[model samples]
Target: PGAVLDLSKVIQSFPGVLPKPSFGYAIAMRGGAPNENRYFIDGISIPTVSHFSIQGASGGAVSLVNLDHIQGMDLITGAFPTEVDDALSGVLLLEGRNGRKDRWGLRATQGGTDYGITFEGPIGENTTAVVS
Candidate 1:
């Protein structure tokens, strides 16, 4: 992969994040179990959101969501809101970008075993559509 964006690469390098190093990449954060953590996108919970999900808690080798479409993320390690009651370890929240209405935009990226293109623009005066 060339110029690929991987969340696991970043997480694996973090302090106190122990590595699994078996097939897939997984991390034990601050001595907590990997399964204790929770990951979310746009308020929706998913079974697995990574290409190497069975291996690493670092978000696998490839993220299921497109990096270019992410607007922001909320990572809470402790004392999360009551609504996020499932995790005693941590929360990784993601927000996706809304399509731009003013003008068309396109982006592409390739890395490791992943590559993709994204397109965004107005579908109508009051709506926008984003495709990846």
Candidate 2:
């Protein structure tokens, strides 16, 4: 498990990306400001990726996305893509995993500062649900 369960922490390992100075959970890509970057989840744009985010800025003490549910992530810096607009720095795309279909499952997590329970199960023949 990561020091912090926030998914954003994963990006810090990537080259050319650095955590913004004096701002928790905020990232600066290729010297661009934090707000210049954009974040997307499954093709949908979200205002902020971190919890307790500041108004008119992005970054906080933690991330709102649960790492357990993430399937994959793509970080794009420089060379803007047509699908992602209005970004001057970078773009992060987060993909969530589908709930289990064969059977129901439950998972509980306890961290130094937080705890959570996740429930996933089949809703119907072809539908599944995941609640955290």
Candidate 3:
């Protein structure tokens, strides 16, 4: 994290956008502050990033979404719907997959502050249940 990120290199990854150095959150889209964004998981809002990361509280939480079960991500910058309010910047909409049709699987991970697990399998011939 020591090395400074080149603005030119970042811009190359996205078309028609520019990177401004002032917004230094570990994960920010464009030049917007973290507070200017929103995050949703499975149609529900996730309110915090770990217990209390200050910057996130001012903006919005960094999602703890697992890519393994993720089905979709939508980040909107300009002109949003009326259903969303209070955000001066953007919205990050995340959608996750239900689970496999008829198979069982388990995944786990741990850190000093948190630990998590996910289990998924079949409930019936055409039904499935996922626990996380």
Candidate 4:
């Protein structure tokens, strides 16, 4: 949460990547080029590394996420276990919270230029989705 994850430091430590306009999308995994990596959002393949520019970097444009709605984050590199393939470099997965399966839940947040809301509840009995 404090900093973005990078693969180069996997053996050294997990460090937070500073949020800046010039920062690249992700670190080169095991010294691989940036373009060789791949990322996903809610299981959807992200064609572009970032949404802000054609270069598709993720530093500035992605800072707009409302942390209140985030469920969890997972960044896997080196030895990925089967379920994930492609991207010889690395993988970043951002998981959002879903229905509570009982009552109802709501989350909202506001930043200088960003705003977001999240609602979770049973659709028919056991189906759920977290809308942003």
Q: Quick one: best lDDT, which candidate?
A: 2
User: Residue 103 in candidate 1 has what lDDT?
Assistant: 88
> Which candidate number would show the highest TM-score if scored against the true structure?
2
Question: Which ranges of candidate 2 are over 4 A from the true structure?
Answer: none
What ordering of candidates by lDDT runs from best to worst? 2, 1, 4, 3
Comparison by TM-score, 1 against 4, better one: 1
Q: What is the C-alpha RMSD of each candidate to the true structure, in Å?
A: 3.0, 1.8, 6.6, 5.2
By descending TM-score, how would the candidates be arranged? 2, 1, 4, 3
TM-score of each: 0.78, 0.88, 0.60, 0.61
Local distance difference test, candidate 2? 0.80
Model 1, residue 62: distance off in Å is: 2.8
Lowest summed lDDT window (length 10), candidate 3: 1-10
Query: What's model 2's lDDT at 36?
Result: 86
Regarding TM-score, does 3 or 4 come out ahead?
A: 4
**What are the clash counts of all predictions, listed in order?**
5, 0, 1, 3
lDDT of 1 at 96: 81
Pick out the ten consecutive residues of candidate 1 with the lowest summed lDDT: 1-10
Runs of candidate 3 with Cα error greater than 4 angstroms are 1-30, 49-52, 55-63, 108-117
Off by over 4 Å in 1: 1-3, 13-18, 55-59
